[model samples]
Target: MELKNKDNNSNSGNKQINAMTEGNPVRLILVFAFPMLVGNVFQQLYNMVDSIVVGNYVGKIALAAVGTGFPLIFMMASLFIGLGIGATILIAQYVGAGDIENVKKTCQTIYTAMILGAIPISILGLFLCEPILNLINTPADTLPMAKQYMMIIFAGLLGAIGYNMNTGILQGFGDSKSSLLFLVIATGINIALDLLFVVVFGWGVAGVAIATIIAQAFSWIFGLVYMRKKYEVLNFQILKFYFNRDIFVKILKLGLPTGIQQMLFSIGIMSIQSLVNSYGSDFIAGFNAANKIDMFAFMPIQSFSNAVTTYTGQNIGAGRMDRVHSGTVAAVTMSVIVCLLALVIIPLGPPLLGLFNSDSAVIESGMIYLKNVMPLYVLLAIVFVINAVVRGAGESVVPMIGAIVTLWLGRIPSAYYIAYNFGKEYMFYSYGIGWFFWLMITGPYYLSGKWKTKSQKLIRQ
Candidate 1:
């Protein structure tokens, strides 16, 4: 096969980027991942602002309410999101292979699935909100607020579903720049509305929910308009979409494991959150604040991991498996460089924690949590990038199994046992311990070169 250049695939005027299928592996991956990195920063701010505004303007209890509801929200969102990940990988392969018709059909099929899937899930999600929160052992004082916050957010399920699908579409095509632009637009709106609704009007927790829903609405609308202007291939007729078993099976084969994996991952986080709730509101508030900050620090690794997916998927689709090893090396190098930024940022943990709340105890407790986890970020980066590489090779089960073991067997149990017998600080240590376990499992598998053959059997099936 001849090595293809970006000009062949990219639209005129360079409105879209085509990094993964061509260019120097290191530079291509970095340039491709940069927009995703920035977009994720703004996206993380969606959660970060919820805590900051609610904490400062309303109270710690309000902040705790927002915190308490997070894992639950993700638990619901990750189900569809897991499927979206499968769609992204498949689309990347189709795009790289230059199978234009299949790409169009797959995108329409996904939108069909989204439209059908969103209705029942939203209904089920809305109905089960309080019961699930109760099952998680949400504190009595915070129960009403958690219920309120969750209900408002889930009510806009269509918007959230639409927005994520749009982002995944751009991601599959190697157009991270357009996605970043929409996210910046959404984030600006979100922050402005958060201040107006929460601070000026005093709507409290509900204001945060309204702002997020509205921001997501903007993102989805903007994404649709962008796709219309730039990518002619993706603008398929939705009305003509019919269920094709082969395409559906192709997507589900890769998607289900990841969906289940993400759902289970959320369950694991919720499990640990339940344990955290047992420690009382201060611990919950502190952990919540600290968790928000921790997400910002970790987004780069997560962003680069997505790069590994697109990079690996496209190269494999193009029959350029030879490029993968060097690309993986580039990803790891970039991830390490990003994670090392924590060393400078973590030491000022006190003043940083002060941004959320003035309470000395909240700051101290949050600092301890951040200190334990932030410096060890590089370990998670290694694990994330490798799993992404393997998964993108069309073997999603490998990472799914790793997530099950790490989250269920290692992290959750350790967090529970440590918090119960030892104390809160020891529970924070469970994260590093779990990442080490994940690295041990996935690292050697990547080195063995067995996944290449395994993916051949899977992808062709």
Candidate 2:
């Protein structure tokens, strides 16, 4: 009847949804993933709408300014987001084990995270925004606009970090529904603010950035209230601002690799962005549009992957290896179906790309990127699910190593070489080739049975 026992039973392929307080893993996962997906879509929509509005109202240069700052912004925020991953896994394990004490301790760690992680990043982001833009080779014309936009976004780093931490806790506790609700609310507010500030008031990129930060702050505050009120285990008063060495080490052990992996991945994107910048603003705009579309196509797989991580962490904590296996099967199956759908639907890329731009040149370039990238969606789905499963099973090292090898050894270097030596057109091929290489490298990590052993060791230890 306990949460851990129920999780164990469910893992044995038992057909009971209500047995686990967390609910049926598949249904629970799907339901949880759906909102998260919607939220992700809306999050993308927030950016896409900004681009559409700016591209039409502000001009291509302003749009490019928004686009140029994305990698840099992501790179700055990656650490906290990566830390959230660590928090999620650890919190899920503790929640599954029904350890109220550790759960509260983990909640307190958020305070440490706020001070140690978010504040510093915010300061760094604000002070270095312009220099970073220059370093990334932002066009002289776009530099001022990019710096203006990024400065506003960075000034609100606390909101971003808070939302991430709050969402991480909710998801970790198997309450992903709340996380989704908060995101939707935030997204709605962001859109409204975007319209008011940009169109009505003529604020431009700064307007959109302010809207985003305000929404993020609202979501974080709302999520915090909910956690304190509903979850007895997460009451904020228990959140003493003290550093527990053991807790810190445990968090870093799991979180640091995932964080570094994300940071490295962002770096690779930034590297690619540098290549795109050389080609001109038209290419940059096209790349940004394609990136947004790709993110939409990728949403379901990402949602399901997060589901797998939570499902696997809880089940593994409860010593339900068989259930973990079954859950992985379900996740991978769902991911493959989504990927196939993407493969079928990607030919509409040109139309979708055109929605953001009226320019024939931008649409044409975007279509080329899609054609090269879409077929690999199927491969990426497998890679995503497998990687999630491994991480869920507490095998961070393999996934980290796989990510490093794939991005550095394959993606970034190939993108640089092809873009510089081969030609601009070869950039598309570089993207495809990098994904293919990722599939090759990461597949073995998933299949080696090493994750199972490592997970068992973690649980036993």
Best candidate per TM-score, number?
A: 1
Per-residue accuracy of model 1 over 404-445 as CA lDDT, tens digit each: 888887888888888879888777888988888888888988
TM-score of 1: 0.94
lDDT of 2 by residue, 286-328 (tens): 8788888888779999999988888887777767777776677
**Reference-based lDDT, residue 446, model 2:** 72
The reply for model 2, stretches above 4 Å from the true place, is 1-25, 238-240, 456-461
Q: Clash number for every model?
A: 0, 1
Candidate 2, which ten residues in sequence have the lowest lDDT sum?
10-19
Q: Find the 10 residues in a row with the least total lDDT in model 1.
A: 1-10
| Top-lDDT structure, candidate number | 1
